[model samples]
Target: MSAVTELSIVLQHDIDEQYQYQPGEIIRGTIYVTLAKPTAIREITVKVYSEGNVSWKGPDEQVYQAQEVYVDSSKAIVDTTYDIEPLQLPQGRHDFPMDYILPENVPSSYIGKYGNVTYTMKATVVGANSRDTAISSEPFLVLRRQHIPVLAQQPLSMTASRRMLCSCSFGKLDIRVTLDRGGGVPGEDVFLQAELKNQSGHTVTAMQASLIMTTVFRAQSRSTEFRQVVSKKRDEMDVSRGEGRRWTHVRLPLPPYVPESKLEFCDIIELDYVFQFRVEMTGGSEVRLEAPFWVGAQPQGLEVPNNEQAGRRIHKGWTVRGSQALLFPDGGPGDGENGAGDSGGQQPHVEHDYDEGWGITLVPELRNASEVVTNPLYQHQQNHVTKGARDIPEELLENTKL
Candidate 1:
């Protein structure tokens, strides 16, 4: 009785891993259609869609929301037949080939509590009768293949110290975190060396290492924040006053589901991560330190183990230098993919104090993103956001970049 019984969109090369598409890669699939009888079809169409949106309420109950769309394309693959007759698709199974090239600027898929960024594909068939229309959609992931520097792939560490006065006795506690490398892709393990020192009268009850993700939502000059501990390992050990403990080369495997650092291409939402080393002390007090690193969608080669180097105490004059993710404006730590490091006769030396424990992306003075040779890694920002050579802000520009 019905013209179409089933309609579905299926990928051709999903033979394996999660169906992931890089910007330059091809997305080949097939649209499977099953018709109950001969159907007069007006047209068959395929569409691609990508979007990011954020919604949350401020303290005053004012709802703040914003959305950005990166891709929305449609094509008609089948149309009317000759002699003004609609094309007839015979009963049984029919296959329509699908092919598409993802754009280079597409961001990765991220599902958050208050915000979500996603990419999807849909195919539709229109029959002579409106009731015979059949449609199908499939969601996929997009990760801009990014690269970090060879230098940034090396080991990195950070320290946090706090002085406590318990029972009128001056005491101190110090904690440090070290990782085999500063960055890696999903499914890889991040080797860690954590140290804890307790000169205070309080007892060390527990020590924990956690991978935390922070998601920030910005809209209309307002923003909200959310933090979740994705992975963590806790060690229960007690060492009384005037003692120190250390663990070497403890493996903390990164979860494959987490998003990449900076989450470029989407403007309304920003996500970052931190590796936290925390110690729970007596009297319900806690001392913690965090080291930041980049996690990407593509994997890098594993370097030599740094077990010996990871345990070394962080000494004076060993100030934590900011990762290249801060100095280079266009990409990741190396960020070579975006063509950021090219310079003039002199590579500028800019000395400024910044947070080393956060994956900070520096601004390269974007006057207009629509202009040629723009910062593809950071074009999602507003112009006035950065202080330029002439002290001109982005808000003053005629055609502000997005």
Candidate 2:
């Protein structure tokens, strides 16, 4: 008879259709086991661990690499002799709850062409008499949050030059490249602006820009780094002697599924990104420039507002105005003057008057000579008016007034 009829593992919650967890998060699950008949078991153990395997082809041979476990936990649910009371075999189903805390510093789970970082949970039931063990295993995902570095906040720029000599003739080439910002989130575009100056005798061939991903692996005290070009865009140009060309803005797209910069928690593996610019010459060496940058998690609370809703409201307001104009022709219902019809209907405009002490001020107006005399500034200016006039004006005014 089979020692264990069925074994299964279940997690508490699903992370995007798969079990995903971050560092320092508790992973809670249950293990189920069933037996066909009553049997004695030595032990039933549940274990959680993570492993990374990296393999690549060297110049002459295939190299295999592995990393230390980022997390490892083992618990024995049932032990025959070690229990306080002797454990008895059961024919029915049994359930065991399992809980494990991931370490604070652990690398984000990754799967690559030559290597992978993975997490798994296993349940094993060992029979007392037989050497065979019934086992079930499951895998989960680990994602680490990336913090943007200060360097990523600033723009990145670099210049490169290459010279060539042919048949006692010499020529030089210069290329300058710049990025708007050093870092970006996935699914966003990184704009590259560049200028190429060709003082060389050879005609310019082509200019290219590429996004490169570098992965570093360390094993057996030996470290190896590999570079892959993830995305690339190029422009063809022909610049003669003393001629220059410029690329105002060339966009390179970032893949959403790519991992962030420097998987910090993992000691053995690291990831980085760089923008590479290449300038090819007709008969000279290519001038290449590379600027390192970072890719990180999207910042929280920076979601874009819903412009569609705003646009709908604006369109609705315009439509309402147009409908009112079409319906009334001259004016709308609320457009009447003082709420009175044009046909002599008495409708006085309503006005609200507050109490006098309630922050209200009144100003008096001057009309005749008596009222004008109360103004001191006006009297003073009236006396000075004759002083600036011609000498005969006062005599003429006195005779004419009399």
Candidate 2 error regions (>4 Å): 1-6, 12-20, 32-44, 52-67, 77-97, 110-116, 126-133, 161-174, 185-188, 195-203, 235-249, 297-402
By lDDT, who's the top model here? 1
Q: Which stretches of candidate 1 lie over 4 Å from their true place?
A: 13-17, 81-83, 299-402
Q: Model 1 lDDT vs. the true structure? A: 0.68
**Per-candidate RMSD vs. true structure?**
19.8, 30.2
After aligning candidate 2 to the native by TM-score, how far in Å is the CA of 203 from where it should be? 4.1
lDDT of 2 by residue, 1-402 (tens): 576888888876643343346555456677888877776777878787887766665665757466667767676767675655445667888887665556657777777666778888888888775743589998887766565667786789998777867558997877788887888765566776778777777877788888898998776566678889878887786777788777776677776556678877667778999888888877765778887878864433322223321111110000101122111223322335422334543443432222222122221111121321121111122345555576321111000000
How far in Å is the alpha carbon of 242 misplaced in model 2? 7.9
